[model samples]
Target: MTEETGRTVKPGRSDSRPHEDLKLQLPSERRIHTQQPMSVTAMSRRLPQLVRRAFALAWRVDRTSTVLLLLLQALSGGLGAVALIATTATIGLVATGRIADHFGQALPSLTVLGLATGLRALAGVAITGLSERLAPRIGREGELTLLEAATSAELAAYDTPGYNDKWDAADRGADVSKELIGDAQNLISSAVSLLAAASVLTVLHPLLLPFLVAASVPSGLAAVRSARVHYLGMLATLEDRRLLGLLRWFLVDKTTADQVRSDTVADFLIGRYRQAGARIDRTTDEAAWRSARITLTGALAGGLASLTVWAVLVWLLTSGRMGIAAAGTAVIGLRAAATGLQGIVGFGARLYRLGLYLDDWAEFVELAGGHRIDRGTVRPEGPEQVEVRDVSYTYPGADRPALDGVSLRLARGEIVALIGENGSGKTTLMKCLAALNLPHGGEVLWDGVPTRALDARAAWRRTAVVPQEFARWPLTARDNIQLGQSLRGGDEAVLRAAALCGADEVIGGLRSGLDTLLAREWWGGVELSSGQWQRIAVARALHREAGLLVLDEPTSDLDARVEHRIFHSLRAPARDRAIILVTHNLINAAVADRIVVMREGRIVQTGSYTQLTAEPGLFRELWLLQRDRGRLPVQRTTTDG
Candidate 1:
């Protein structure tokens, strides 16, 4: 039994094509059948499950806020009913010339009305306060989840279009717990009023009750119509919302402002803002126009219902079947009931729309269940060769794989140097071995044990990577290095890491030394240069007890003299581990135990520097290019790599 439709449908490209509009698609299991008896038993069963989950999430923070918000929500509905009845009764008393009786019920009713208003207002305030408090905690949790997924998602998932959509659409449902609870309160308020009004109206005139419900049809439809329009409007221009968010950040952020003004980039920023604002304006304008049409439909429905109630009242009055005062009061009560019903519909629409966000949020949080990652407890028994299988990787939404059929192996305590041109997939390969990004098709084996079968994180613990960009935590220097070690009370380890990475003397010169806050955002704190920051990042990474070390352009930001000294100090210790160094500077290649030269995602040559320079290939070409540019003779160590 298919449901009746109010609008014509457009033809799609093909039935096999996945729908881009999320709302237009039906949940195959939850499709409605209008021809059947209107039984909501299925929907009702699902409602409690959703509510219970929402309540559980809300309860994670504290019990007080949740309980209080629900209480205020339910109480406010009862008060609205009392206020409506009292007003109608007041009209009746005044018509009958019983002025004193009007004040009795009316004054008490007004008091209830005021109380309800105050509570509702307080509830709004409380929700805002609670959400602000929860945002950071939930954000931290979400960040962790995101970091884990982005770093360790299945190799194939990263290469799929599905993951791409999920990655970009994340912000739409980011604030789930807070918004879900807040929306529940609104829905509860509407439901409570509908229950009260239905009870009161039934007792007044049972036959008229059906007519009241019938009159609600237009307004109820209009509410749902408005919500659909709002959702459509938001979806049509999501890039605009994202752009607006970014533009606002750039305009107001202290970090971006200096560059924004000095580099004449302000015009560019303003242009972006203008384009984003135009899109938002277009979307909102269409919604506002549609909203006007819905508002008119609702108004007509209410007016006709009011006319019906008055006509009924007049019939009773003129027939000498009821007093004028009682008749007037009944008419007022009937009209008030109609309005209350409409309010229920309006709020119900809000709840339905909020459900969209809620559903997306549930899916995002439970992405963990989707992963089902299997991890091993300890590293493949002992130090063995690091072997790369028939590896290939393709990034999400890309035309071709980044690497193809690549295989390599390195024994323990060997230094391997990788030299490649820009975008030759050197960084990507390094990230794979470090377990930051899983490969699209291939396996990495440690001591003959497949990494996929081992505890990925625990394995990662015994590895360190100096990635292209290092994260600068807004903390003191001491705390930054301390974060690397799992064990507490490792001041000696922190000091040793800092000393080994050429950061100890620089840190000691600060007023607070290692205790000094490294971020300028804090009071009395100072910022460091790029080279200084990189040194700190290296020290932090070195603080960990890792057997395999990957250094990706670690000295790129430093001066030539400093870099020369760093290599001299770092060589012996780095050689004791299975170290892989990635550099554009080929002068250091001579010192490595083996040099792997890559070009355009394929390993073109591999040998010692003395052997590779004689081969006519990429390594020689790049070396020649650098030499032509007068960037070389960079203090070559003359060690046989």
Candidate 2:
């Protein structure tokens, strides 16, 4: 049993909290194949692909920047090598004679050294500028690709196990895509420097280059291990971090702030936040300790190897196997090579970690996170009628179906009301009709063609929905109604729709009238009451000029007067379109030409309201219950009067 939700979580399923639970489980844990560190061979194979992917993205984003960055890195490395050789020549000139006598002879070497160093610095600056320019474009491209994949996927993808988790990982990958440019640049620079310096060392002596590589091996291993540890640890605790963020938002955001205080859940929520955070902290601390120990051991081994290399250099000089000038140059060459090796190891490790994330992004985009919409190419015109045929749907992680062999028919020029208790699949059936949820066992057809045969977006363009939780857009009152699309009649059409839903009265009172911003949080904005927002939501739906309209408890937040006005007016314009209304209010269902009563995912009753009231069934039972309750206020008022 957990202290947060007081629910008993099964063993081996520690992170299996329900989606509706305030305390979220780690979806990423279920998504990942393993938490183990990647093998060296695996990283070696993956790095080349990631590097190619990064450069490809950079080239596509800005070809000029990509070319300049490559040129600058190459130039910088070559200049550094030249500078080292020039320094050695100057040293030999000074060593072979008195400082005063060699001054004139050394001037040329000194000039070469100065010029090489100056040019390398300039190249470094140019590389930094180009990298900065390319990074943001790469990030933006990554984000656009992610959005395209996510938005194009089926709606059911969000309900599938590991799908949401994969999306979250991909989102993080997109955010860090900007770092790829820097990592790629560093890898290129390091490789060039290491190659150039090692060549110089080999010319000085055959044995010197091998010893330098030997010295760098241990540290390289350590850096890779540390990076792997950090990345795996982060992946393990991804959900806990998300949970903490959710709790903080609940505590601080204005929407939930009042509830948190009124319900006195601040202490409980804070406790959960701390507990989730502590879990992440423990994982992070363990990883840090392990990485530190590995790094320390590597450092000690590297130090010993470095000592051996220096001792060998000393012996070569003392025995006259190498000249003093060559030995001095060897020392500088070894240091430069070692620095390059260290940079290679460190940046390579970081790049490997980043590559893992980019892999997530790339994989998600390629496969559409396992939920790509693959419907047919048929483009739907305005649906004259929609029919459901033995449709059944079972949501992810559920045993029972939400809609079990449900069948219904809706035609133009009529209003169909779906009346049922909560969880009776009314909303599911409505979504099926809208082509939003493709059935698993049957089909929903528009104009006698299966919805799957119609292009999903084109089919949806003919739907106008005002759901129970309607959007309170933070835009001008006119835009709220128009929803970024202009009708043939333009402003006149918008006003007519608003007038139909009684929103014109609400708009008339705003400080800027139709131009007023609807969000109170912004400057020159005003907030509307719940009733007023419902009016706008209805108006927005009415303005769409769609053939099919679905209203799920549209009047739930409206006043009695507005609700009456909406219900009374629905049938007038519905003559030319099909309207589906889902409401618990029996009085509202009276306006529908047909009332479909659902129970336990099946249609139990179907008839006009007057016919259903005369028959004895769930509809009549609910009608009596509400009818008695409706008369109670009138009865009380009569007695009091």
Candidate 3:
């Protein structure tokens, strides 16, 4: 619950809230996780886990197309073998001085070559087109997976750095998976080439085939090792990489634009930018150098094996151990076999490398799957009774509980205000009430049912949280509200919510109103003042069909007059639903049915305005101070920001 939205709004106000005496309160409870970062060796240990995801992606795609594509590559490779035989036959005829007479056979062989080439081209085109189609589907699946993970994530996880790193890794893995079809196509081609070579070599000399196949082993192993090293390095660099994003935002973001230009912090950021860039450059250079070294060794080994075959042939020729024609075909088959093995090794290595990342993605996908909500019909129906009993929580890797032992109960349609100073657990407690967070201990009972047993997504369906830092969507004003509702863009419900928040007028004044995108990045888009954006955000939250509304400083950016007016206007709806506001404004505390003041994660006072104000404690002192401060000239007025 938020304190700001409980206040009324003045219908015609165009100024910012100017009450320095008024402030939003904190939550009475908090939950935090305390997990440590995974060691570099742990991430390294997970590389082998990626293979399953790669195979899964390939197998789950259109199977018929996969089979057809492989068939086409096989046809292409068979044509190559046929061309070789035709040329060799022609060579023998030419040596016998009879090639010119065999023009008819040559014409048929050329015709077969042309058809095979054309078919291969068609298969290549089909595979490319199919892959393009499959990419969007894969991307959609990835997004859905990510959304599920985010929705199911423990509330305290949002306050941690590990969550961000895991998210970045998962995002990269998804992107790579979308592009993996190209690698799959290459693998198919390589397999066909190897098969063709093997068939030809068997006829020439079965003994020579193993050496060609064995030559690719070193390159395959090197590629796998290189991929593992690269992934491990990437995992270790998450902190520095995250710092780079922050540095960019601090330097280049539009909201920060004014700050950097006026505060002379651009120079400071430039130094950080240089440091981050140099670090990334060093990593990149090392990886590239290592890859080059591996490639050289693998190539040298392959070349050495090739030279050995030539030496064996020369020895056999000198000793009269093999015929000239047999020797010639063997030479041709060995070269072809080596080429086929190269394709196999190349594809195998790439697939193996890709497997490492896909495994992480696979784990991410599994994580997302683990969080899938059943969307149960069980809901907090009539006369819901929410009780927070002996609840306590702490953040991950932190020692102190953000919220200590706290307990409270509320009936349906009750409007309560939580008042506290900064750092108190007011907001955190409210977030818990909204089911955004769970109690680290004890329970939050919904309609007398323990929240721990309730479906989290279902609880979310009946609740909406408009925090102090609300989201401003990079879309039209209409879309901002529509996003909150079951309906999408251009719906009448969207305009209605805008009207309720007094933002319809702002949209009407725009060049294209609801159609105009709000982001500068979009064509025909425009930016609004923060106050106006806040109003729109309010409307968006109001648009949601929620049974419980938790607004944390929802009107912090609003004018006092407007706040007063909105609270007055929304009173009817507020009385019909469970409304809890977290605010420190004594004026607002006066209107609430009851006020709960928190301090140091504990509820120090809870009562009606007169009850708490008359007591000689924290609430009494805070009220008197605000009451006296309202008279100061330096104090902000009701009109200006």
Candidate 4:
């Protein structure tokens, strides 16, 4: 069924459009909807577990600092209680009519108060120092853990939207590890203070304790409500935020600057940016208004509760049930109790909100770790014959398969060329052969054993690929080539590889030769032309010196002379290693021992270039088209015999 976004909806109704805000909600929305505005009882039940988890994580980061921070916060709260008691004692002593006699008694209370204040200040400093020491370590540990998971995950996981969403959410939550520690500490501090205040109120009178609790409830509820609104709003707008970020990058990034100007797309992109911004603003404003309403209502209710508490205190005083000194202490206790209660409630709400993101991080970590690609125990030295047996593979969410019933065999010391139109399954077949991707149906075999049954890492170690879209690494020319064989250091082999690909000529022309950095943004660094970069990429692939080499459109950016030279160089290496070359240029394919032509995810013809061109087929038609366009030159070959 088609949705309002003009996308054909799947079984789960996943929306493909980036701009369709209401078309789909984040997966988290389902959980939120099931439990909207979580109750205080639920929060109370979960708080202990969350606090323990946070402490354990913090402890893992720095046990000494975590213990010290907790001790300091507890001490600070204890001092606050001591200071309150001392204040009450001083107030009682000052109530005495004989100032000279009572001065000595008041002096001890005053001294105790000063000591408590000083100790509390020291605790604050100690707590701050410990927190600063621990937070960064915790954040670093959390980020590293997530990064490890991301890098180690199965390559196919990256193709799914579910994985991407979870990854994005986890990336945002990485900092929450530090935040959770901070929140846990705040929760502990606030709870301790609240207990101290409650004890003071209880000492004043048992009735005052209930009155204080009643007065704090509404504000706590308000905090919970506000936190829920904010978090849910963020969940709803996550995709929009991502889109806005991408648009901003397109508008400002140096890599896209030329394209933006050449295509005159700045105004169109800006309009989209403004639209996304406006949508975000509307969502935030709606949340703010909802929160404001809840807050105002809570304030009104809390004010009434406070007035009732005061009225009760006044009645007690007027009826001679409470002494003036006790009444004054109770009034002071009430104010302190209210402040402590608010602190506890506010921190609790914040901790609960942050805990949700932490859960996402935890879930993503488990998912990444659990779904690892099975690198089997069997390890092979090298394959003499790599065979694809009825392989078929489809991308995630794709209706049609990228490769279907494709079978081929690659032998050592032979050059095989793959040629096809775009989306013709050539690259997919090559990826399967390289062990970068495993087929959904059937199997690829190394020698006589299936590749999946052999160790994937070991199998991949024997292969090297220069993809169509090769990475332009921001490093020195030497380092860029050396990265292909990182386990081995740069030496004569790297230089030889560079020379063989004609990249040495490009490097020789540079100011510092091989030492010259490829990034233009860095000091004393220079950029290379597209063709020059392509040569570097070719050099990098050649540096691997693997048993099998796959080159995909490797000469697309090179001049005719350089292209011919690279192809000629490959022929010498073909004596020992298997070579798979994919290209559109018919002349390049003509050099290969075998040429395979694919159409619509299946190989249609497999023969020598001359044999395929002699008959009327896709290859002949393509050759004739190239000849007519003056892209192909006539050359005599021994295949005519």
Q: How well does model 4 score by local distance difference test?
A: 0.83
lDDT of each: 0.67, 0.89, 0.67, 0.83
lDDT of 4 by residue, 1-641 (tens): 55565565556544663443422346655466436657688678778888998888888988888888887888888998898888788878888667687999899998998999899888988877777777788888889989987876777776765677777778877877887777778788878877887887788778888887989899889988888888888886787888887888989887799999999999999998888889999999999999999999989999999999999999888999887777877787778778778877888888888877777788778767345676676777667788999999999878899999999999999999998889999998898888888889989988878877888778877888899999888898988888745645456777788888899899889999888899997665899999999999999888875778899999999999999899989977787788999999998898899999999899899999889999888888888887795555567699967
Cα lDDT of candidate 1 equals 0.67
User: Which ranges in model 2 have alpha carbons more than 4 Å from their true place?
Assistant: 1-32, 35-37, 522-524, 630-641
- Over the stretch 125-178, how does candidate 3's per-residue lDDT look in tens digits? 775776666666666666666666766666666675355556665677777776
Q: Which ten residues in a row have the lowest lDDT in candidate 2?
A: 22-31
- Show where candidate 1 strays beyond 4 Å: 1-54, 64-168, 246-265, 314-336, 368-383, 397-399, 484-489, 521-524, 614-617, 628-641
Could you give the candidate ranking by lDDT, starting with the highest? 2, 4, 3, 1
Q: Against the true structure, whose TM-score is highest? A: 2
Looking at candidate 1, the ten consecutive residues that score lowest on lDDT are 30-39
lDDT measured at residue 284 in model 1 versus the true structure, 0 to 100: 95
> What would the per-residue lDDT of candidate 2 be over residues 444-547, giving only the tens digit for each residue?
99999999998998888899998888888889999999988898898889888888889999999999889999988766589999889999999999999789
> CA shift at 113, candidate 2, in angstroms?
1.4
- Which residue pairs does candidate 2 place in steric collision? none
Error of 3 at 385 (Å): 2.6
Cα error, residue 388 of model 2, in Å, equals 0.6
Clashing pairs in 4: none
Off by over 4 Å in 3: 1-67, 77-95, 104-144, 316-326, 369-377, 484-501, 504-508, 511-516, 630-641
Task: Report the backbone clash tally of model 1.
Answer: 4
Per-prediction TM-score: 0.77, 0.93, 0.83, 0.89
By TM-score, the better pick of 1 and 2 is: 2
